[model samples]
Structures are given as C-alpha cells and as structure tokens.
Target: MSDRRAIPPHSPPSPCVNICVMHKTRDLCVGCFRSLDEIASWGSMAPAAQREIIDQLPARRQSLKRR
Candidate 1:
C-alpha cells in the first residue's frame, strides 16, 4: 500500500544536504534525512512536486548507504 493523499497547488521542497550521514540502525542518513514534518507534508504535495524531491533522494541516499 502507498501513502497517497490530497495535494494543493504548492508543496514543500526537498530537505537534503550534500553532506550525508547514514545511520547504522535505520540505514538512513542522520544528516539531510527527512524529518517527521516532511513525511507528514508529503501526502499534501503534488505528484510532480513529489517527483522532484524524490529524484534527488536515491543518489543522495545511495551515496550514504554505500559508506
């Protein structure tokens, strides 16, 4: 199942940083990782808006995950 929801004309942007830090337990970044606020905000973002943020995630996440 997905966490799809309603979106408005404007949506929040990506929360990322060039400096990444992967958490040992979560296998996610300690730095530049999405906060609870961002996740909550996602469902209200447009598809195109979500895509824009998502596109940068994989590379950034992968870079951290690799370390």
Candidate 2:
C-alpha cells in the first residue's frame, strides 16, 4: 500500500453566493462581504491568509449595518 496520506484541500470554498453587488459607499460585495482588494487577491492568497480574511468578514458586515 502507498504510504502517502490524503491531503486536505488548501482553499476554503468561496463565500460568494452570486449576489455580486458592491455596496457603493462601503466598497464591499454585499453577498460575500469582501472588499474589492480582498476579492481581487483571494485567488492568489495563501490558505492561512484566506482564513484570516474569512474570520474578519462578520465584523465587516456588522460595521456596514451600523452605517
């Protein structure tokens, strides 16, 4: 039998639900709550970095609600 263990996937599935609308003043996609920069960089970011952004998403959304 082969010795190699199955590796977990590196990228977390995207949060995008195809809503795609960027809130004009906040500059974040309303569906995924990612800033334009975050959205642009997501494809290239390391998995750990991507997780950090994901962790921040809820707070970002909350801030939007307060505005």
Question: Candidate 1 regions off by >4 Å?
Answer: 1-33
> What tens digits encode model 1's per-residue C-alpha lDDT throughout 1-67?
9998875555445565654655665555566654445456778777676777677666766766676
Model 2: lDDT equals 0.89
Q: lDDT per prediction? A: 0.62, 0.89
lDDT of 2 by residue, 9-57 (tens): 6999877889899999989999999988888888998888889989998
In model 2, the runs with Cα more than 4 Å from the true position are: 1-9
| TM-score per model over all chains | 0.41, 0.79
What is candidate 1's CA lDDT for residue 11? Answer: 49
